[model samples]
Target: MAALAREELALHKLHTAEHYVSKAGLRETTDQIMEAISGVKAAVDNMTLRVDRIVENQAKLRTTRS
Candidate 1:
């Protein structure tokens, strides 16, 4: 009976440790995903600014040509 109790206690500790490790892994994955999303957003914003400048330049050229 005493041996069985020891075995149960060991298993419980192992299970708890696994839970914490899993949680940490999930958190790390979420952080990486958020970082990637931020990079994409910054790239899109840069593209938008470049497009706006091009449009403005084209408009100015048209006026000068006229």
Candidate 2:
């Protein structure tokens, strides 16, 4: 009976440790995904600014031609 109790306690501790390790891994993954998303958003914003500048320049050229 004492051996069985000791085994059960060890199993419970192992499971708890595994749970925390899994959560830590999940948190790291989530952080990496968020960083990637931020990078993409920055790229898109930069592209938008470039397009706006092109459109403005085109408009200026049209007015000058008229």
Candidate 3:
């Protein structure tokens, strides 16, 4: 199975505890955490794509200069 991310792990621990946990239940916490993870993953993906594009552009520029 895939490993849970840090935020997901913390949520799971919070839900499992007997008392003083966040008012949000497991499903709600899970949903919110998933949304956060999704946002972070999307940002990372976008950054990766942009970096790749930049690298390609640099290579093209270098080749043109040679």
lDDT of the candidates, in the order given: 0.95, 0.95, 0.88
lDDT of model 3, residue 45? 100
Stretches off by above 4 angstroms in model 3 are 1-24
Segments in model 1 whose C-alpha atoms lie over 4 Å from true places: 1-21
lDDT of 1 by residue, 1-66 (tens): 999999999999999887766768889999999999999999999999999999999999999999
User: 1 or 3: which has the higher lDDT?
Assistant: 1
Spell out the clash pairs found in candidate 2.
Answer: none
Q: In model 1, state the lDDT of residue 50.
A: 100
Question: Which ranges of candidate 2 are over 4 A from the true structure?
Answer: 1-21
Candidate 3 lDDT over 1-66, as tens digits, reads 345687798887887785655657767889999999999999999999999999999999999999
Candidate with best TM-score: 2
TM-score of 1: 0.65
Q: What is the lDDT of candidate 3?
A: 0.88
